[model samples]
Target: DQQVKQNSPSLSVQEGRISILNCDYTNSMFDYFLWYKKYPAEGPTFLISISSIKDKNEDGRFTVFLNKSAKHLSLHIVPSQPGDSAVYFCAATNRYNNNDMRFGAGTRLTVKP
Candidate 1:
């Protein structure tokens, strides 16, 4: 079963525009949600995170929303730049224990000039 899924493997956006990335999950016990931004041949870096207790969280130019009841989450980026063109992965962790996390295949966001 796909505990976590990012149906679309890639997304494209023009510079200075808003980019939205979507993710879905099957497991309900997942309480902590995280979004990671990755570059070519590099490890993913933590972007933003929200606890299942809350519905939304924001930081600077990035924002994340979590819908516990629906088991879904999304990431939004504003004023996207060419450098923002990279892979983004939606990941989730179990609530009960610090078990391994699940990551989406990844969504490559290409911000064209």
Candidate 2:
């Protein structure tokens, strides 16, 4: 059973446009959420994060929104750039299981220049 789900396997966007990625989770116990970006043959790098206590968190061009009631979360990249093209993964971990992070399958984002 998948705890986290990224329904869209891939997403395409024109450069300078907004790219929104969606993620859903089945476990409500999760208290922390994070977004990671990975390039070919590289490990995932932390991009942005949000605590379950907060509904939204932003860092420059990236923003993460969480909907606890719906058990869903989303990452938004405004004015998408070609450099943003990568595999994005959503991860969540609860206080009880701080060491165990549940990760989504990952969404491949392609920014067309």
lDDT of candidates 1 onward, in order: 0.90, 0.97
In candidate 1, which residue pairs get closer than 3 Å at backbone N, Cα or C atoms, i.e. clash?
none
Clashes of each: 0, 0
Stretches of candidate 2 exceeding 4 Å from the true structure = none
What lDDT tens digits, residue by residue, belong to model 2 across residues 33-107? 999999999999999999999999999999999999999999999989999999999999978978989999999
Per-candidate TM equals 0.95, 0.98
Q: Which candidate number has the best TM-score?
A: 2
Worst ten in a row by lDDT for model 2:
93-102
Which ten-residue region of model 1 has the weakest summed lDDT?
A: 95-104
Question: What lDDT does model 1 reach?
Answer: 0.90
